[model samples]
Target chain A: MIPAPVIAAFHPPRRTLLGPGPSDVSPQVLAAQSKPIIGHLDPLFVGMMDEVKALLQYAFQTRNEMTLAISAPGSAGMEACFVNLVEPGEKVIVCRNGVFGDRMRQNVERCGGIAVTVDHAWGEPVDPAAVAAALAAHPDARFLAFVHAETSTGALSDAKALCALAKQHQCLSIVDAVTSLGGVELRVDEWGIDAIYSGSQKCLSCVPGLAPVSFSAAAVAKIKQRKTPVQSWFLDQSLVMSYWSGGAKRAYHHTAPVNALYALHEALRMLANEGLEQAWARHKAMHLLLRNGLDALGVQFVVAEPYRLPQLNTVYIPPGIDDVAVRSRLLQQYNLEIGAGLGDFAGKAWRIGLMGYGARQENIALCLHALQQELSVVI
Target chain B: MIPAPVIAAFHPPRRTLLGPGPSDVSPQVLAAQSKPIIGHLDPLFVGMMDEVKALLQYAFQTRNEMTLAISAPGSAGMEACFVNLVEPGEKVIVCRNGVFGDRMRQNVERCGGIAVTVDHAWGEPVDPAAVAAALAAHPDARFLAFVHAETSTGALSDAKALCALAKQHQCLSIVDAVTSLGGVELRVDEWGIDAIYSGSQKCLSCVPGLAPVSFSAAAVAKIKQRKTPVQSWFLDQSLVMSYWSGGAKRAYHHTAPVNALYALHEALRMLANEGLEQAWARHKAMHLLLRNGLDALGVQFVVAEPYRLPQLNTVYIPPGIDDVAVRSRLLQQYNLEIGAGLGDFAGKAWRIGLMGYGARQENIALCLHALQQELSVVI
Candidate 1:
């Protein structure tokens, strides 16, 4: 028998979360999560789930009936859209600009779909002209996949323009709104996005477990008419729909993440209370405040202003500054956490997130002050 | 823009969860989950994650380094083990006795593996003789997959015996301990189990979402040397391990469910404090009390005494009783939730779970009293 190790109660240190994702969550959402654990199929919980769906629809700006949270993270949501919609040997045009875009290409290849690439530089938006060119060149492409907001580089592509191009080429569009959903303007119906997925942790400020996903009627129809079964049974929308869509007697797909849904519901309710336009404005305003402060500290943003994401602000580390040491000091000394850059910007940049609950003026002020103090010692 | 529906704050009803899974969570665990949100990669959170890993090691009775919680639920955990280990066209001997066993077969097939079947009656334990026969017949079978505790049937197969047989046949054992991990006697190292996955909600009494999975050295080796990449990118262990294992600077695979991990750590820590054997004895003793009370109510257990699981007690619906009406009354009036039968036993049996925090004498008394009151009017 393996002996139990003597471990103390884990009391996590409270830190202001200003990261690429998993931004600071509100006390209300945390309290909602801590409410009494109910059965997944309990009547009251189901009622709450319906409300969650409605709230998510409002957040995505879509009236589609297929909107519901995936049981995993945003990456799983990305995989779900591809595995369910892109069958084996189907050609999908994938736009590559940053880390998440590369992840989209990986998902396409793993699902046995050939990925036709349209490349753009990191810290830049997906060029609509390049996408149009790619779609025109590859007329056989059945789907176009791109990230609406690239978390790794804090770049926001023009999802509307990209979706229009997909439509022009007769290709269904799969959009990754993981970092863009509540923090930016995303109109699923208006943009004609066939499939879209977003994370609860980023802009929704819910805990980082659930992924809210929506499918257009076309996307749902494609799933229904797939010649082969969806490779991942856990993510198959066709089977999962029976559980999320139908009334009262929902089919058992997987045990719904009971408490996480509670948090999501509360987060989305909070988001609703603060109108989507208001939330977007708040994020943009906070980003500007942080930008002014950081500019005073000689910090330069990686992305151009027009394509930069308000929620995720990617800035280059100044010369002679050690990336790990500054982030470590900020976390340890100031009890503040900012995300390190990912992919191409790993050691070269830092991502300062002002997402949802973290978008307040105080958080941005605190983050800028902490960074200034930490970087002063190094730079 | 879609109009936001006005929704009230969700106040989940207080429930005595006595269901097949998602047993009553402790107030301590719930409180732990409400702690301040931290970044998934924050140093303190990473330190807590290490502690969680250590506590999980105590719970699984193994020192395997590959043990970590999947961000999704148990079904995804089941899929993770299958997709990572079983390659296309690979033959795996799948033991079927209940709903979860059938799910294992689904996972195998979804991963492009052929599932060789060994069947047992729904409420019966997996037949070791049949398994041995199948292994002998299919010498090329690389994996033996079975559920140790079938949640749907309230049956506990002999995991030690099953794993030993798989060892003798040179097949790596994949055990589904979703309901068995903390409720029963499970020794991963001693039993020679290779890959094991479990749900946090069942015996662990944590909020539902995370699936704790562990891989033995052989299982890890097999995954590392796979001819093809795992089909599901989200469930891929090879990439996930880089994030979970090794030193301080861990790779970023996915943003983990921070609050849920807090709950799991507390739940596992509580289990460690209680001691595994003591926990097993507590579940067994509570089951006995529940059994006596249920017996007084004229309830007949479906599984034989030796094979019956202490945590999930499956009993036949007495003749002429309305399953829906009785369960509904119990839920509506008593604020109690019990699982209706699943798979073949739907509407024919009731699964009374006395799991983890729900396995107290008072809970047992309340469930029996509630059932008696509801049944009197219906029967």
Candidate 2:
């Protein structure tokens, strides 16, 4: 009954979404975005959900029994993983090298778990030695939390080494692979990661909304034996499991965003066809292209070569140049979008993402030319 | 890059989305849904955000300075309202008439607030006199929380009377108008409601991923003076406001669901064209038509006429009838979706939603015919 208003559509100049995450969506994914929304539990939608889960498993390299998409964005995925796995009064060893790691600490604390933080410099990955030392120090720790790829600083951590450290201390490991899953090599099972969560954006190239999460058999058992009920009834795995895992007769949680799921399924299907290793290699190759361009323009990377993520490249701002103004000009003039540094490096660094569909050589060339023009004004 | 899949051009089915919500999206809104994704802070997107705020103000009948859509769903909106308003040790009077009200109570408790509940029968509206009495008894209560419309039971509460009572007692009112919004007449300013939240589904007829929320100046002041920090950094209104409010420069909160906002903007535009009063009348008339059809069959309404919501209609299931079987038949054969009764009313009731585009005459005829065919054996 709503009368149609003559509100005009506000179309931004077609910019490459080359940010830390939510990279440029493929035309097919964008078309999937317009699919008719069906009921969350509609048989057709449920079929789509099953396919999404299967594709997510392929990307994460995990055979975990509890693999599904959280209804909210990546942040809620972090909350769900921590709140469901970390019980009240439990001690959690959280490794913090960047913003996402700090987010993990916040999640653990909000869940009433005492956070034992192992702090690292912003651009550095979580050192396995430091994580092992922290695990040894906190003998009563129930979980070890770390980010696999630090989106804020483009640092890629050694997830396998950290998981091994947690295993040595008899602690379940929770991994935040929000910016990792498809762009990098992540073998959840081989690395002994008990719990992991990822975003649909970033290398997955899906529009941002759902969070793909997985829990190993050990983590599910821990949830099963929890002494008290989870505070967040909405995000509780036990309740969510009935809806996500049970076939045919799924319980109602919240209304799933049916169209978004269709898009995610399409994006994941695209990933499946690309082959996980091939996708990872493609991302790395694209990163090299971007790196070469930036280096040619005298822009050095913030993170060293060996540790940096291929998708998210953090670079220090040149001395005396206004970061915001340069980014603004690039956006307004050339229709290019890049990321500003987060937290401590806020005014000092710029993050250029060569991710997913935005990772094409054409986009890299376009960005280089645009940045060169925009930076000439300030530099 | 995502591998190209064979993407069929989107031509959504013209079904009546009449279950709980995502009530028939209009063609205009569907077209809006396909608009290209833009950066969350793109100037054009920011301008669109302004229009969205203005439209929301019209829909909620408010002039509150803090009004914006949460990037997540209705549940997240519920969480935001609680996390920001009800700090630990605060006392909140929660009126529980149905499922969503119970959910509010859960949020309050999880936020470490003391929830003093005013109970009502599932199919009945909340008693304003009871709420007044509770407010009088708990004079120290900081807020009164209640649902304006109970979607699960198809009941409409006296939101104006309840808000008046809360104001008289010098307490803030946190209202859940998720189901009532657009379908029911709500005057946020006239009712003196301090804080209110709504969903994108229901009468809005958009998708389900966004929640529109608003806060009065008084409510904003209360939040500004809170002693303890909000537990959820993400949902904290203070943080979200910097991005949502049209300040000089928007602070980054999280990536806004770009294309989804386009769909919501289009829905609001439609609402703006159709005066709110006219829209309300349309919903009422549609409900009347649906009632006539239901009466022609052997079905009886679970919620009585006086308190019934025109948008959601709960009907009693006859004895010996298989509720699941009938719902399955409706979905499989008719491709028509209706809601199963929630909580204690499960298997006892079927909720038929006459909302937005789903409230048309053809939809009513289709729904009635489908129900008649399925219920003939049981009745």
**In model 1 chain B, which range of ten residues has the least summed lDDT?**
B370-379
Q: Tell me the tens digit of each residue's lDDT in model 1 across B227-325.
A: 999988899998898888746879999999999999999999999999999999999999999999888888899999999999999999998888998
lDDT of 2: 0.85
Query: Which stretches of candidate 2 lie above 4 Å from their native place?
Result: A1-6, A375-379, B1-14, B319-321, B375-379
Tens-place lDDT per residue, model 2, A15-114, is: 7878787788898887876776777777777766777777777777877779998877888788889878888899999999998888899888877889
- Among these predicted structures, which one has the highest DockQ? 1
Q: Residue A67's C-alpha lDDT in candidate 1?
A: 95
lDDT of each: 0.92, 0.85
Q: Alpha carbon lDDT of residue A88, candidate 2?
A: 85
Least lDDT summed over 10 consecutive residues: which range in candidate 1 chain A?
Answer: A370-379
Write down the TM-score of every candidate. 0.99, 0.94
lDDT of 1 by residue, A38-137 (tens): 9888878888889999999999999899999999999999999999999999999999999888899999999999999899989989998888888888
Cα error of candidate 2 at position B64, Å:
1.3
